[model samples]
Target: MKKLIYSIAVITAVIQFYSCQKLDIAPISKFTEANYWTDIDKAKLMLNMGYNQMYSAGIMWRDEFLSDNMVHTYGTSDQNSIRRGEATASLNLFANEWKDAYGGIKTCLVFLANVDRVPGMPEATKNRMIDEIRFIRAYLYFRLVNYYGDVPFFTTEISLDDAYKIKRTPKNEILAFIHSELDDIMNRGNLPRAENLVAEEKGRITIGAACAFQARAYLYEGNYQKVKEYAGYLINDPSKYGAYQLFQYPAKKEESYFMLFTPENEYNNEVILDITYVPNLKYWTNMSQMAPISKNAEISADNPTQELVDCYLTMNGLPVKGTGKDPAYNENDPYVNRDPRLSATVVYDNYKWQNKNGSVDVIRTAAGTNTSDSYKGPVERQTKTGYYVHKYYDWTMTPNNQSGLNIIMFRFADVLLMYAEACNELGKITQQEWDTTIRPIRERAGFKVAAALDYPAAKSQGEIRDVIRNERRVELALEGLRWYDVKRWKIGQEVLNGTMHGFRFSGAGGDTDGGYVRVNQYKFNDNRDYLWSVPLTQMDLNQNLKPNNPGY
Candidate 1:
């Protein structure tokens, strides 16, 4: 029995009704407090509500716009505004993200407070469920602190008066709390290892998830030692955390990387934590807005930028520009002799786009091309950039583009990359580390050349860091992680400033900078853009939320 909690179950109605009310108001439901916690299934239902709020596919997809990886051209979006350095404390993105994260935290608290009253639940099962809720709470807090430096922190639900008066906790304190909470949950030994989970419990929280999340937290904190120690748990002892390896297909090596996102590969060992969705039931329609215009998509909201395309190294592991360039890289035919992931991720001019009826069509995005996907100078429902995203095309999507593919939040490849980065930062990276982490990732990406797999000789620490960072970018592009990486690396000004470019169409008209399409000029205030402001609406409700982020 596939027992993953589909988010659209009847319990969702109850959550929606309660979620709309203010946080100060008590969660009202048809079932009174006395009867709601009487059954184990009801407890699970409440937990499912927390799962639904953990992550959103739409938010994840839009996050790329905040980074240099993508550009929004259709119209103004909150992410676009923020990227352009026009974000105010009143931006809906800030308010909505704050509200949604707290709502999720509240769901976890409610579940933890009432689950003990559930009758006939096995001690082991109840304890495991409690840890799961705790993990969700920690994850929510992690997001909150990452976005807003300091926020009002809480564990148990509070009264209306207490909620209003609660002051902002220091970001460091919140980070420490998250670390301690995750450590306690993992040390308790109630959660199962990733490999031990049965089909019915596929999407439940595991020890590996907690460990990976902790490592990511340390990564954001720039504590390389802690990142190494926590990420080492999975890298060194798979028997303890879980045996996670990059998903590969030896017969079809080139297609292995992209195939990992297909529906047939859901619940693969590579995925550490993912949002669960059921076909024809709980699904997302964001793909309809992202798919190619020629492929019957409703609208093209954003497009991959040339900056992201340039990050992919050649098959021989050489840069396309700067020092140690690829000698065979052709300027006119930039797609050839490049990393296989680039083709898998983006659809450029003359790209092959497969259709629902098993037919393939070539997408032409150059100016004056006879195709709906052609470049038309930043018009509505068209790609401003001369490219379309091909990484997440759900073959099993409905005619209306409703897709049920689970969105992976954490995966094994990311774990390896994190370990590699931490090792490099600590100056402890060796050939063995390279073989285990970067080498395998490149190999699975269909890179057969020894230069791409073997550890480079006579390279300084800085050079190795660049290689690792570039590898992480191409491997994890369009996964909503680029923005966090940019923020953590403090390269917002270096990357976000100046004009973003699209495909190079020689002799194209209108806003062409030496044949490159000028998508848009962006600005990044290094001091203020690094942290988002506390929403003005939030501050109005609670005067304690004073002293907003700088330059707001």
Candidate 2:
């Protein structure tokens, strides 16, 4: 079992500063503010609480709904509302995310304020813990600025009254602060490297994690130079930060890509950062909502779309559309002759699903075998897109589908992709860089053809840009990163304003768009949909929060 050592009870201190008549009567049994910060363990417990609030598996999975990657079967979902261009200032999704991010920030602030008060803690340990808390704070702030631009930003714990009166700060200022903090943490050298982490410290932050975040931060800022600089720190010299590589299963090389998510592969070298979960201790139910109904999934609310499915390249590393279109693509057998990752990530028509009893079951989504009804029937608890998410499903999970698999936040493959994008954007992508990044990724995904593994020497920069973006999409599909990519790339209107499709059910279909199931029609106002509206409830709580995002 992969244990998150920081899974301890949180110790809260209610400091009473003003006592009526100066009564010196100290409580004998209860822990007070004066007595709480005396032990190092208590400080660890406080930091543990911050770790618990850092990231959530459920929220990560739900974020996929914001992009074209996945769709919610229920029309009333918050994500669906946003997809339909009907988002309001009162949307609970906005308010809840805001609340959660701030809640995590507050935990980090509280830890930083009192951690020094703990007695007998080693200086090295203290500094490392401080860096860890700083990373958490930066991560939460990044989440805030990414969702709600110009959010109320603070470094220290504030009074409830002050929180109510605080005004929103410019998002650029917050981004600069995040970059600065991460830089300082990396330079300070307080955090351990990924390779140096003991079993007890498996899920803690490392220098590589900081570098990865810095690269991601620069990517969002569109500073390709800085992106290259930060990402190169890990790509150029892994020994200094941490050693990382694309994980490959020697015994079953064909299934290497799919095996990366199995519980047995948790904390692999490819994983720089992950949300740790131990069986029967800390697990998630999000898979229950996305898994196939035939696998005893509970809700089946989210499903993969044809837009994402079509993004996968054919076996010869050719697109299904445009000038680079694969000549051998068969509409009648769309899934065949495609990249191996297509089968690894998605359960499409005629997919071979593995069973617990060492059996293989063919999932025919269009014909409704080993799955819910076909897309034409439109049943509740069925995949409306005629596809199911196959990645990250723990087959060993109980019937309830509660899984202990750690959700990867930062992985080496993402670093490679970021580096490749930065190089391409800077017009400096050499074959050497291609070999270092994209080629290895495709090779590890079972690609053997020279066309799939070799760099495109003839393609223009714009065509190469498309290649890198598509590579990132198929490589990181259903991993909760597509929404950020769509936003940062500013392609929302181009991709989000069309009717999404499903499997080609030629005959028995009442609503078919050119023989394909019409899943849903979406709208995206590029003007307002880029930034979410500040929740109306938050605006009511603080008058300084007026003037929500443009279209709300």
Top-lDDT candidate index:
1
Using Cα atoms with residue i matched to residue i, what is each candidate's TM-score against the true structure?
0.96, 0.94
Candidate 2, 208-249: lDDT as tens digits:
999999999999889999999988999878878999989988
Candidate 1, residue 46: Cα displacement in angstroms equals 0.8
The segments of candidate 1 whose C-alpha lies over 4 angstroms from its true place after superposition are 1-9, 16-21, 24-32, 354-359
**lDDT per residue as tens, model 1, 1-552:** 135455346676766655435643222222336666888877888887777888868768977778899988777889888888899999988888888888788888778777888889999989998998898899888888889899888888776667667788999999999999999998999988988988888878899999999999999999999998988898888887888889985557678897888887888889998888777887888777677887768888788998998888888778887788899887688888788898788888888776647698888888788688888777756677888888877889888988888888899999899999999999958998889899999989989888899888668889899899999999999999999999999999889988999888765677877778898889899889988888888788778888887889
Q: How far is candidate 2 from the true structure (C-alpha RMSD, Å)?
A: 4.5
Model 1 vs truth, CA RMSD: 2.1
